[model samples]
Target chain A: MIQHLIVLPVVLPLVMGVLLLLTRFGSTGLKRSASVITTLLVAVVALALLLRASNGEIAYYALGDWQPPFGIVLVVDRLSALMLMLTAVLALGSVIFACGGDDEKGSNFHGLFQFQLMGINGAFLTGDLFNLFVFFEVLLLASYALLLHGGGKSRIQSAVHYVVLNLAGSALFLIAVGVLYGATGTLNMADMAARLVELPAERDGLVTAGALLLLVVFGLKAAILPLYFWLPRAYAAAPAPVAALFAIMTKVGVYAILRVYSLIFGDNAGNLSALEQPWVWWMALGTLVAGTVGVLAARDLRLLVAYLVLVSAGTLLAGVGMGTPAATASLLYYLLHTTLVTGGLFLLADMIGQQRGKAGTRIVKGRPMTQGGALATLFFIGAAAVAGLPPLSGAIGKVLLLDAAEAGQRLWLWPILLISGLAAIIALSRAGSTLFWRSQDGDRGGAALPRPQWVGVGLLLATSPLLVALAGPVNDYTRATADQLDNPDAMVNALISGNGDTP
Target chain B: MESLYAITTGVLSACGLYLTLRGRTFPVVVGLTLLSYAVNLFLFSMGGLTTDGAVVLDGAGDYADPLPQALVLTAIVIGFAMTAFAVILAMRARGDMGNDHVDGRTREDSEESRR
Candidate 1:
């Protein structure tokens, strides 16, 4: 039963996505119904997966019942399970938000959405490097379609750059994977980790080069540093729901980095002793600088939200770079907060854009915040949560990460973090104050916004406190997950011990 | 023989990088393709060069690292798809924006205009 639940999140979307494609000519009601059902099922299965993971790591299936190194594996350990849940939650929220809109541009929207979810969940769960690449392509293809769904000129222009940059990254990723397989003679991640240990020290340099290539690939996907120029333009131009979903996509890249680096490369045990600290530290610094500068440079609200996504990426990378149990826990915590808050902000951007039309520049106007009454209030709360105000989930996660960073004696990391936080607060608060407190523009009538939309905002705003309250449980779970991530030996032993089938 | 392959990969990478930094979309696409080739070659070389190593497991004295070859084969297919997609997207952007430069705005003064 537990194993069945492990595959449910990935399988459900996949089957539904294909089914949706077959029923492309179906009625709008049917398509919407199918989308809702699929999303809800995914949510339920993901919850179950999380519950099962609480017990410990679970290697749900070996492909064709073949054993390690021989067949593909899909493991649902604590990290993958948590990510699965986050993906499903965000997908559910985005789909609901999509339905709220007036337009139904095409019948294929729900299908493509589900397909993208399938890719994300598959990427998270797969234990093979080759399979990871395949799933990434799956997600990319679906995203290409969704990004251009509305087929606007600006959207297409941005999507072009987006596709090209990611394609370059994908090519680099493939090369890296090819090199790794050649060196270790296996694609299964755990098997590769084990094999890499026995190789000569010179071979370690080759492996490091390949790992760096893979890191660059994942970095582009995660919107790190120089490669991140493509993100703000592309994400800001995407449709609101699509933009919301793209929030999770970067997290997928971060997840891959965490998994591959920590499991396969970071713990090589023999050849890694010399270079580990300085290398990751520099990478973390690059991420921090790129993200803070990106956020501070933004002018529009949607662009501001996009840039904040970069900031979160920087912080997460820094946390990972610290490379301690506490640091990893903080990274995981921050990741959770960042995903929800960023998704919520993107949705809020859509709502604000719709209400104020294209003329809505900053959330703040000249003297005061704009008034949508309760809707404005809800938006403010969401924005505040994103800026890491006290009592919010973001603040709690930031404190955890800061504690870990300080303990690691990464004193230089502190100022960058403070600057990033301040920049986020300024950008978000300016937007919040302008949107909620200022009077409406004189040209526009002071008409009241609808209640249902405010209800959506309220729902998101309500999650902030709940996440904050659950911070203790969330931290405990993350710490345990981090332990498994940092040391996969026991998990690998269990798998190899079970079937002994090497592919 | 290994050194020759290494040099070829280096030159290809340089060419790719130069083209990638060009202002036009077409050059970037071409550059990316060239870069992919260089990358693939470098990855293949990592397994060490064998004269006639076949990936298929025949009575096999020593296979030239069949695993890298298998991985590279998939990568080639995926790379072609990505390049095709990117080129098509570039053409579409040209049609939509009426300009083929990577950035939608020209070299001079657009930021000021937006401000």
Candidate 2:
């Protein structure tokens, strides 16, 4: 039963979601509690998995006792466990915030929320490629509803583009998978990696084409440059809680890139890896530049935060592109910091919007807020943390990332990162001053938001510093995850040995 | 026979992409549906077409890979759902904003509002 914990994260929320859907006609109170309890349970299970995986333990759960290369498998290693924990943390925060008011606005919000978590968890844990596609659809389907949760003109408008782009992305993903399966007769990741090692040199071009196609799919999802146009508009228009949840969605794309690239097409591969390296670095840099410009040009608070999300994606991918264990480790740490801070910022932006009323989080001159001081303080912390100010996890993560880049002797990386950091700081300061300081209206104190909302934002804001406090252990875990990915032989061996064996 | 399928997929994709780039929402949705069809066909063909192959694992006759078949079947279902959702969303946008443009605002709407 303990071994079955691997599947619980996916199943718990699925069961809760169906239950919530069945009771959708009833009061939302019960549904909210059920969803919250399910998310909390998932978080606890994920934390347990993270602890178990800290020592680089790889556990494979084969459904129906079928062997690898044939049946579906779910593998939980340190990287996946970390992602699960991150998703759970963000999902918990988003759900709590949504329960405050957003969930009541839409029918089946709780059900959709639970389904979203199940999809995300499944995507992280599934060890097969086809299963990954199915989970992607599940998540996207739920997200489509969540994006339109509180029916608004702008929400549906932007969501149309978002849905269409992702549909195309899904189609591309299917094409990539089909091409990959055709090239190498396996959809299992480990088995595919093994097959690649022995594949005839003649079919290398076909395999490489499939791999590049997969890259395009993941790149689109990650919102890497030229493909990120859908993000700012869609994210800015989403309900705050949904937007906060989306903070982890882009990371899913990054995680897939890291997983697929490192495991299936490592630098150890002669021609393919060589061809991919420069392209990744150049593309990552382009993303960073685009994100920085967007941050500077954003006209509203939520849009600014949305752009910063892109910046974080760019930064993470840049580090991963460096292709060093140190770089990968720091990127993991950076992913943790960015997810928490961005989610916190989104929730905080919503609260600010609520307070400002007609001004609505726009960077223009707005009315004085009721809870100006408290909200200002929260915004300051969130902005500073995300901007990589000192004494925060963002700062630590950035420093580690820079150190890794420098160690890797990548001269151009540190400059771009530092410059982008500067630009973000300037942009965020402009936003903070415009929102908090410049406005001195007739209002003294605005209405106070509810207790749960404050707690949700506060918990999310506090998580960044907690990362700083536990920097040592978290760094060690990320380093171990990086090391594990650096050498896929252990992972491959583990999966293959588990063949035909029932635990 | 293979060339025919390949050309059909290519032509469908090209036409789908062209329509997808149109400014109107209906065209975009139709284009997406077309593109999905093309993709489904492409995925279906990946299994290497077999004329007289066993559908099961008989270990005797030539068996076309059934995995892509299953995958394509699922993809077709998802594509249908996605098309339905997109159409509804487009309808909702039109109802709410009185426009079917992707941006919810046409240039004339912006100009008139500004005036």
Candidate 3:
């Protein structure tokens, strides 16, 4: 059973999505039960895969029982499994939070949600580049529908921009894939790595151009600088649950970069290592600065969280470009920490919006709430965690990141990271004070929210301490994952001949 | 023959880029569609544009690589879906927001913000 668990993460959601669509007009209870059951199943399978990978094992599954480099193969190493586990955890929490109130916004929400998971999980699992593109489209298509699920004017407006921009990105992706296949004649990543080693120097320019085009596409998706303007608006305008689920979307772009760069282009002798792309670091710096500035300037809570997403992406990408094992390890850790914190923060922001009448999460004075005390406490915990205050997982992740950056002799990254963190603290404090501390114009309070909503937000918030408690093992796993990424020979060998021992 | 395909791809891509930069949403969708068409053509030619080549298995004569064909087929389907979604979104935006500006704001909103 465990041996066959690699495909379950994607297959379960796809099956559930079809079932939910068939019963779209059924009772809410049925849809909710089916969705939760499917999500739990996926989470269990993802955890099983994670455990299998943790013991230094790679699980490879070829669909239709065909051999790899010819068939569509699903490869599960520590890094992909780690990403899968994080995404499952976040997806489950978001679904629970959505059931609180957001699910009523549109028909077929559950179905679309499941389809979105299928896309994300498929992207994480696939070993071939073209399948990655297909899964990317699947996820984006689902996200487009989910973003508009509520059917609001603002949502539709933002969806237009998001759709157009990503369509362009997809077009570029196709061109890149064409160029790469034309030059190398293979779309399998591991096979590409092996082929790249023998690629003649004269053909280097074509491959390099293709690789950089891919970087731009991933950069746009990851919300890197100058390519990130579409994010804040789209994320801010999205419903809370959708935005929460989207916390993992940018990381998908980052994951693609990490996987492809580490596996296909991490060749020191092949002249394709990402270290040759110096602009990544500088762009990361700009992104960090831009995100921090956006955080400071944002007038609404959700938009602030969206900008913070950029901040996290920048930090992780910077760590990626640092190209050291320790840096990569810290990046993997930070990636999980921020994904949970950001998702939780978005849910909290929604709860706060409902509590404050007329203000709706905007940093302004509004009517006082009857549940002000509890909501304020929840907001403080989430905000403090995201702002990297002491005694939280965010703070620990920051320390690890800074330590790794320092070891990499990227001293300049220190000021940018620390200063951006400081700016975030200021921004969060200002927003928190305005939303919680400022008195209401009128004393007409809104209705109290459901218990499950509080529990959902609390559940996500609780992971902070849990991560801190399990910091040792988690850090070890990430370090091993990073090491595996740094040296892809074992992974390549496993896929090539299916006999190599994993790291 | 190769030059014709290349020229067509370039011309379509240039037009697509121009349309994509427009402030309105409809033109942007059209731009993306044209761009996708160009990309599909480019991808199809990646297998070396073989004429009179067999696509079936066990062909003895010269054969074009079939992988790109399969890939472009998938790309075309996805591109069509994306274009359809974009057009629907544009129509929805125009209906709900009363305008189809990419930002969902009108001329006055920008001017006021500038102030």
Candidate 4:
């Protein structure tokens, strides 16, 4: 049963992706039904995994029944299970948005979308470093296909950069894994953590170098500073639903960083403390600067949203870098908020783009409040929430993160966070002022927004407030999850001391 | 023997970095390949080289670390796939844009949008 839970997320998507590919020959109804069913099934399975993990047990499933230090392991602890659940939810939302697109392109869209989810779920669940590489490949391959699904010139150009940069990162990841394996004598994460402590002091420098190399690999994936130039361009050029999906992909990289840093490196037994602290701070600060600048400099609505993602990622990492239990909890909460809000904003941008595309104008020329009234209202609400305005999930998470940072004596991050938040608000307002506030000159004809456009934005808007209203339960869960993440002794003991027999 | 491998690793890494910082895509790819080789060798040495080491463990005397070798094998395969994907994408980009530039058409897009 435990093994089934561990494999279900990836296997379901893998089988469904293949099945969806086969069913492409069938009717449109069949593809839609298959995709909707598959996504919902994944969501349910992820929820079940989260519930199981909340019971304070770390479930490990070893491939081929091989013991530790030999077999690849799939771990479903509170942290990973939560990320899986979030991925499933965002995936479901993105699929729905995809379905709402022009039906002629639905089949190919759904197929590639499911493949991307397979990669994400696989990345979240894999327990060994090498297997994580395979999962990253799976995700990137799907992204390449999906980014080009719309087949526009801009999309293709962006996809090229996206593919090239990620391939470079993947090569570095491979080298890092090779070096790590050489030093530790094992690929199993738990085993690596155990062995890292016993390595000679002279080897510590080598180990830290290898770890930093992996950091660069994950950083590129996460869109941290210096390696993030590719993200906004690539994401902005892709179709809206695809961009929303890409939003979650970067977080998957951050999730890997968080998981590996805390569980394998930051474990009390390791010498990573000397290295992890300063590295985290520098990266986090750099991320904040990059994100803030990216958001402020964007002119396009989609590009603005993409840059805001960078900002939120930076803010979340700042919290994580603080490395306190409270900060980690705040980081987890912020992760959830940022994923949802960014995803919602991207979906809204898609709806706006579709409206603009249909209207044959660069500017929306109408009384948006009256013409696209409901959508305009919902868009503002969602955008405001994302900008960390009060009475939303984003605000709740920001407050917690700020508190945690202050408590950790990283108060200087507070100003950067505040400025970024202000910049996000300014950018959102600028885009909104152009998009929703301004009336078109009489020469330009304003078109009516479609009802389908409202549906996607409306769904996201409705979901954003729940993150705030449910903050109590969400915060508690995130806090408990962070506590477990910060101290993985229980997890390590379970994996090492499990019934002493191969499955 | 260890010192020789270290020197080789340093030289390969330097060459890889030099190539990486080049402006052209082809040279960057070459740099990446060289860097990967250096990385693999460096990782292999972490298991500590033994002249008469065997990979198999049938009571073999002083079997070299199989772990790093196993990891390097995966890395090599993945690295090859990465290089293939990158080269294909580069080909596609050049075919599309009629140039081998890495920055894509951002300048063109900005100028066109302005016009």
Task: Report, for every candidate in turn, its global Cα lDDT versus the true structure.
Answer: 0.77, 0.88, 0.88, 0.77
Report lDDT (Cα) of residue A421, candidate 2: 93
Global CA lDDT computed for model 2: 0.88
Per-residue CA lDDT of candidate 3, range A377-418, in tens?
A: 988888888888888888989899888875444577899999
Residue range A278-352, candidate 4, lDDT tens digits = 776768788888888878888677888888888887787677678788989988988987887788788877666
Tens digits of per-residue lDDT for model 2, A1-503? 88888989988999888888885346777777878888999999999999888877788788887878688888899999999999999988988998888888878888998899999999999989999999999999999999999898878888988998998899889888988898888999988888888788987998888888888888888888878999998899999889999999999999998888888887556566634566677788999999999999999999999999999999988886788899999999999999989999999999999988888889987888878899999998998899999998989999999888854445788888888999999999999999988885676545778777888899899999899999999999999999999998777888976632244
TM-score of chain A of each: 0.93, 0.97, 0.97, 0.94
Q: What lDDT does candidate 4 reach at residue A359?
A: 41
Superposing all C-alpha atoms, what RMSD in Å does each candidate have to the true structure?
3.3, 1.8, 1.9, 3.3
Estimated TM-score per prediction? 0.90, 0.97, 0.97, 0.91
Write model 1 residue lDDT over A1-503, tens digit each, in one string. 55466667778899888888885457877777788789989988888878978877555577676666677788888999999988887877777777765227644788899999999999999989989998999899899988887777878878877877777777788778877876677888878878877887677776777788888888788877667888887888887778888999888988988888787765654665223345556676787777777677777888888888888887887776777889888989889888877887887787777667555545445322234565566667777787788878888888888888754455777777877889878767766666655655465433444443454445555667888888888889999998888776866675656642222
Q: For model 3 chain A, give the 10-residue run with minimal summed lDDT.
A: A268-277
Off by over 4 Å in 2: A23-25, A406-409, A499-502, B107-115
**CAPRI quality of model 4:** acceptable
Q: Which ranges in model 3 have alpha carbons more than 4 Å from their true place?
A: A23-25, A275-277, A406-409, A441-444, A500-503, B105-115
| Model 2 C-alpha lDDT per residue in residues B57-103, reported as the tens digit of each score | 76777888888889988998989999999999889989998888988
Q: A456, model 3: CA deviation in Å? A: 1.5
* DockQ-based CAPRI category assigned to the predicted complex of candidate 2: high
Per-prediction TM-score, chain B alone: 0.85, 0.90, 0.91, 0.83
Interface DockQ per candidate: 0.54, 0.86, 0.88, 0.45
TM-score of candidate 1 chain B vs. the reference: 0.85
True contacts kept of 1: 0.59
